[model samples]
Target: MSDEELSSYLPHQGDRIRLRVHVRKEEETPRTKKNKLLTVLQEKLEAARKKKTTSKEEHNLEDMRNPHRPFGNRNAAKQNRMIEIGWIHKSNQRSTQIRKNKGGGTRKTEIPRHATKVEIIQQAIGLFFPNGLSSKGPLTNFNFDLWDFADREIDANVTVADMYERTKLPILRFYLATSQKTNDIGNTTDA
Candidate 1:
């Protein structure tokens, strides 16, 4: 091809080819709690810088926002306060008649942090014993108690937060047990 034909095929850079560019400007202020926390931290960081404090314990806003960082996001504190728990159907010689009343499979639930063992047992009774603890059938002579995974009887006064603090486990498993009520002579009675 001749130079004249090549020049016609390729246009010069001086041609009027117009293009539009768009830019977006976000609002300068942030109103959320996280942003407020970041602002506070930034202020503290600035103050520390002015004082020439050591950089070993100092963390930037990005580090504070990271979930993987244990000390910054408040997850550890929240995690230590709550626990997921479930109930299992446990049977003994006295509870054999009520064996068929085992409601369903273990359904794990997150109970309130301040819930006590008695409250948990009541809630579990509602779930595991839908027919109610009637005074006519197998429930007549027996009372229900909650037992932990280690087969230890749980105290009714302890809270779920206390259990979480003591066990330090995210999930705590418990079982329902029936104990026969006694009369004046400490002997089991069916009255």
Candidate 2:
């Protein structure tokens, strides 16, 4: 008997026939097109940027028009400024151990404009020396000093507001000078 004749008598006779399938392509909407989508997104971003800038400008204008208004009183706002403090040896070399123990890199503190160098040092001590200073510790007989970017030591009496007035920068960067101690062998070491 021929295969076809035998297949027609089998229980799975439909297996002998091959089926053809067709797939339909989905239609693209106006916004689904790449160029159209990008254009729409760009327009939205531009509009948002313009709105934000205009609102800021309008707020500034309002503040200027009524400087004494309690609703927008600048004096009532906190005049805190950001300060970055890092530890460095008196030789100006960065201390890896100190940096690693101090959570790596410079520590930032937000202080009011009227804060003094002494206050900043206290804050720095809290950040780097959690247990506070001790006579038995490495910082014994050592006092930290604040140094500016120019490597000049800042006076303890100077206020942050004065520094800001001179530099006109919102954030100030400074280094805490590590004290050097001489061992019995006459070798200098960083405390």
lDDT tens digits by residue: candidate 2, 12-130: 64543321111112233343589787998999999999999999999989989997766743432558877888765543344422465444348888888788878887777676665
Measured on C-alpha atoms, candidate 2 has an lDDT of 0.66
TM-score of each: 0.46, 0.51
For 1-191, candidate 1 gives per-residue lDDT tens digits of: 44455457545533212111111122446467998899999999999886665453354655767857657436335633434334443333433223333444455666677778887787766666567544333455657788776768899888777776688775676666656676789777653
Going through the candidates in order, what is the number of backbone clashes in each?
0, 0
Reference-based lDDT, each prediction: 0.59, 0.66
Question: Candidate 2: lDDT of 74?
Answer: 48
Clashes in predicted model 2: 0
